[model samples]
Target: MIKIAIADDNSFLIKTAQEKLSFFDLAVKLIAVDGKDLIDKLEINHNIDLILMDIEMPEMNGIEATNFIKNKYPHIKILMLTVFDNDENIFNAIKAGADGYLLKEINPKDLHQGILETLNGGAAMHPSIAFKTLKLLRNPQDFENRECQEEIKLSTREIEVLEQLSKGLNYNTIADNLILSPSTVRKHIENIYAKLQVHNKLEAVQKAKSNNLI
Candidate 1:
């Protein structure tokens, strides 16, 4: 039986992870509310083989916990399970020694595959996140200087698409509002992510706002 642990602040997310793990017939040894709790639990029960860690938590974040865990328990693998896929967070997690990174929206099959891959001494990353990791490796200096100082250029339609995204609207809704096809809206979003150098909608909106582009 593969021993696993989950650490997340949200009870709902914790339950969701538990449900997904149940499908694989693996043993869930521990469920921690936050990073600190995870460390404390490991003190008593350090027999876990893997940990599904959440990035944002109260007391201590996943990155800090990963650093601590790796130093004390090098044998245990940690896979980051989070919603935020921004470059900064991803870079920090890798630097802190996370074995793998997967978004929370992953289905059960992929999550299981990711866990297995990590245990087999392989890194698992979402395709988009893998692309960003390659980008970071290609230009380490760019990641070090992530703050956008120069003006960013975005087309007028892209700005409109971003505005709708900021309002928490889905692609279909945004397409309907802009009177564009779903494929066109998706293309606009892809362009926005590339132009802003962000990986997700939240990051794109925040970057655009900070740069005074939207």
Candidate 2:
């Protein structure tokens, strides 16, 4: 049986995840309330193969926790199951070493499949996020690539906005930093999103990173 651990702040979510996981008949070895508890469990049980982690919590967030896990137990696969779609969070999670990224709204069957696939040396992402990943890849203009006469035109201000966004800044923060009204910032972001054909920040940043735009 594949040994798996779950870390989430919500007791209901923990129980729900445990129930969903039980259908697969894999060993549900541990459940942690926060990042610290998760790490503590990892200390005692080194055989866990996969972890379903939540991004937000009291003691420590999932990003920091994932980083610690990857440093100490590089072999353990982690699948992020959180509500946060912030580009910075997603990129940081990827950098810190998450095998897959899934949302909390995922169906139990898919969640089980994601776990099995991760354990079997494959990566998985939510379908919504996956779509964004594709759009980001096709944007040659975003990254520095020559030999293209036809390119999506982006104003300097728009580029500036996208660059900050690619760095993981939220709309409000980006607006404040740029000294623009929140509405103006939102408009610029909307234009960028439309030009890039991406739905969310994570997708936009992923595309930018792959192109070395940020």
Per-structure clash totals for the candidates: 0, 0
Clashing pairs in 1: none
Q: Rate the local accuracy (lDDT) of all candidates.
A: 0.93, 0.82
Among all windows of ten consecutive residues in candidate 2, which has the lowest summed lDDT? Answer: 141-150
The residue-by-residue lDDT of candidate 2 on 91-161, one tens digit each, is 66876899989998888899989998898898889987666545544653442342211255667898788
For every model shown, what is its TM-score relative to the native structure?
0.69, 0.63
Candidate 2 Cα outliers beyond 4 Å, as residue runs: 134-214
Off by over 4 Å in 1: 147-214
lDDT of 1 at 204: 92
Index of the highest-TM-score prediction: 1
* Model 1: per-residue Cα lDDT over 120-210, one tens digit each: 9999999999999999889977766554545467889999999999999999999999999999999999999998889999999888877
Give the RMSD in angstroms, all C-alphas superposed, for model 1: 13.6
Error of 1 at 51 (Å): 0.3
